[model samples]
Target: MCNALAFVEEPTDKHAKSDGYCGRILRAQTQGTRRDGYNEFRLRVEGDPENYQPASIYRVTLYASSPSYFRGFTLIALKEGTEGTRDDHYAGKFQIIDEEDTQFMTNCPPAVTESTPRRRTRIQVFWTAPPSGSGCVILKSVPFKKILILLQQLLHYYHYH
Candidate 1:
């Protein structure tokens, strides 16, 4: 699920680079990404994703086991389909927890991105779950790197009781 993701950001936004693709620089679509390193980085959600409360905030953390800092990053909340599949459209809205390091992307689903050209690890991005009956949500993230970037990745989830 991490290998296949893409989005466009407005060029006018000071925080946005507008590579036409937020993660992996969009060049991987033709060339290819660093396939040997998918698990090195991922987004981590801090609660029960399946039982998310309507209109509540959930904390999403960027986890990078790699020593490399990303050029940028983008996080999106995608609604889980009927059978754990992706719904195609974004699920809920994203909140910028670290205003100094992150900015909200102007997308219909409303994602968040890194404000600076380079970003450190473990920054948090908050998300508001959709209203009642919104079902489950899957948090996806793609760490941006112009060269030798890893593919997009889904969140590393920990179920809460």
Candidate 2:
């Protein structure tokens, strides 16, 4: 049950992404499958994601644009070009930093998530690269923006009622 792929089923909700691609930072999520413009959220990696050595660790930071914050999120790393492929497995393991607020999910890719939602502008975590020969990886995430999250709750209430 901890495998957070959550229905992998399409969210029929009007607010959900039609393609069901949820949150892919580097992938092409548009009409022509081109990368979208930068959002208010940023996922910054301290090391070279393209040249990471086997079994190495890198610092990852998620920052929301000033005056904005998020309460929860899920982050995962996948090797480039492996999206939706049978080999689309997670490329590394995450080192938990805030045990009180964050946790590593037991999902197929063993991603990291918020254990207890907390509003904040930035969240940091460390990722250990996979074994030898693992190439560049793309960190992907779906951040629950604070205000939008509240809007979603209201929408859900109205939709259900």
Candidate 3:
């Protein structure tokens, strides 16, 4: 069994905008499978409801106490015939466990559609956890530009932008 599994932040209006936007981990659960365990997580990013940019991209990072326990990661299943491809929205693997953190970007559209202008976008991810371990995980989200700089420093890679 996992030792500590909790949402990094509760979904609320107050926490909806820490800065220009607010990133919250809405849910995280572990499901037992025949071969391995699946750690499912849901993250939401909220911007100004009245002035939110649907095309805006956000960078999300997942930190684990035992990084090696996470063998693989995949975004949750999406609706068929969706307009966007995972490659179109997903930035792919940024930093792996070797760097003590895992990072990715949400370049896709919001999973949930609102009748009116809504401030929030959400995505689901599945992390393959080792069969036996007691590790904790935490997540954070920030603007893509900031994360790009940080990734360059952490990864020692240069980006034209």
lDDT of each: 0.51, 0.56, 0.25
Model 3, 1-161: lDDT tens digits are 33222222221111111111111211111211111442232333232122212233333333222211222232221212221233332221222222122223242222211122212233223232212232332332221212333334423422321
Task: Sort the predicted structures by TM-score, highest score first.
Answer: 2, 1, 3
Which number leads on lDDT?
2
lDDT of 1 by residue, 64-114 (tens): 666745666666665554211233445667778778888976432266777
- Model 3 TM-score, 2 decimals: 0.22
> What are the per-model numbers of colliding residue pairs?
1, 0, 0
Q: Poorest 10 consecutive residues of model 3 by lDDT? A: 14-23
Error of 3 at 38 (Å): 30
| Order of models, best lDDT first | 2, 1, 3
Among all windows of ten consecutive residues in candidate 1, which has the lowest summed lDDT? Answer: 152-161
In candidate 3, which residue ranges exceed 4 Å CA deviation? 9-120, 143-161
- Residue pairs whose backbone atoms clash in candidate 2: none
What TM-score would candidate 1 get against the native?
A: 0.59
Better of 1 and 3 by lDDT: 1
Greater TM-score among 2 and 3 belongs to: 2
